[model samples]
Target: MLTTTTSKINIQVRRFTIFDIENLYTYLTHLSPETKKRFGPHKFDKQSIFDFYRESDKNIGYITLDNENHSIIGYFIIKRGFLAHDRERLEGYRLTLDNQTDCTFAPSLADHWQGSGVGKLVFQFILSDLKKMKFSRIILWGGVQSDNTRAVNYYINLGFKTLGQFSHNGNNLDMIYSIDQSTGKTDGGFDQ
Candidate 1:
């Protein structure tokens, strides 16, 4: 678990639980339309929530919450080689799939929490967890929309390289991040 305080309000990072479904659902349900657009393709279906709860070789979820309120402020998922469209594009990069280290990353934060430095915090926390898990690669889920410059830029700023482009549900940019395990090195361009 990771805990941080912003102006005295504590925020924490932790794995999801069966009981968290309601809070997670509430957060997804309350996501602004604009938030959905950038992060869309992500839906609030309760079944999807259950699927995440299942946690298998295919999908996993993580979350950040205000410790006092227990409200989800950030949510992220990593899915295995399930998106056929993603696998086809990733194969071009020669990424080894169907393993522990290779997966797709999809993260979304509450609208108000975005651009407020919460993202970097969550990422730092997640990256460390990934390192401990010995993961070496992470891909953007569904690819990123060609037009969402902020999200694209955010990924790039974090050391992700644009791998290619494909039109699945829309024009998306396939990107990848390769981690150097021995040294725990990354772009680390953003401050911790």
Candidate 2:
């Protein structure tokens, strides 16, 4: 879904399919330990990967690749519905989001690819794709860690607003990104 080239890197965002196991394995295993931690410790082997997307209707991930070599370098995972973990946190703040219109996302890039201007391109594509799907609200999956300042700042700059904090297995800050569907504008507030 990436529409423009950045830093001479042609990135393409494509929905994951069962055929992409090998590519996904290569991408996941090549990531440094820190990157993997940030992305979560999900099984990426053949069988697990296949089972993971079996219910593709509810959960989908976009694989972003450097089109030059056609290798996956990042991911944007979107899970439809108010994920149970997220629901509890939002409720703590007295905010109950709509499951039908809201979805949670976890966007991550390979260590070397991060902060290289490709993230903006990836997010641009993601926003357009989600808008087409008629998603009214977006929230970060699992919430942002209290100490992860870089990620916290990144989300804030991209129009995510903090609803409050909740201790859900860890200290996490609930964030919401609201979109004005009629005008296609995101009016999510930011921390000042």
Candidate 3:
């Protein structure tokens, strides 16, 4: 369990479970259109979320909950390997990624908590968890949209290196973050 002083909210991250269905539903459904437009890895409806929970092993889900209100404030997923599209796009950089040492990451925070520093806190927890799980790097699941300056800056600040750009549902930037165990520092810079 971890706490966020910046957000002024007592929160803890844990594996998502079946019990979280109702709260998770509320969280997903309530996302503003703008938020939804930026985060569309899958359907955000109740049935889709339920289906995701049922197939949790395919991609591990984590939820950050507010201790006081017990509502989910953040959600993330870690897939053990890269998606086919991601792999193909990354190959354009002439860098082959190893499935054993690399994984894919996707993260989303509640609308109200979007710029509250809570995302950074939760991300730190995620990095630690990934290291423990033996993953040495992470590729953004469905590259970030180029126009989302806030998210792009967050990734760059966290040391995610931009590999290239590709047009998907929109203009997207492919990025990768190598986990450095020695100093927990990343090779920071933008490739584009």
RMSD of each: 3.4, 4.9, 5.2
Give the alpha-carbon lDDT of every model: 0.75, 0.74, 0.79
Residue pairs with backbone overlap in model 2:
none
Best by TM-score: 3
Q: Residue 82: error of model 1 in Å?
A: 5.9
What is candidate 2's CA lDDT for residue 61?
A: 82
Model 3, range 1-192, lDDT digits (tens) per residue? 455544355777878887888888888888889988887767877788778757756678789888788889888888887887777678888877887788988889988888777777777878877877778889999889999988998899888999899997789999999987766522111011
Residue ranges of candidate 3 with Cα displaced over 4 Å: 183-192
Q: State the lDDT of candidate 1 residue by residue for 3-89, as single tens digits.
A: 877555368887777778889899998989988877753458877778655746466678889777789998987765436766666
Count backbone overlaps in model 3. Answer: 0
Tens digits of per-residue lDDT, candidate 2, 1-192, equal 343454567667778787888988888888888766666624767777777788456788888887678889887788886777556667777876787789888888888888776666666667766788888888888888877776787788888999888775578887888865776442111011
Candidate 2, residue 33: lDDT? 89
Candidate that would win on lDDT:
3
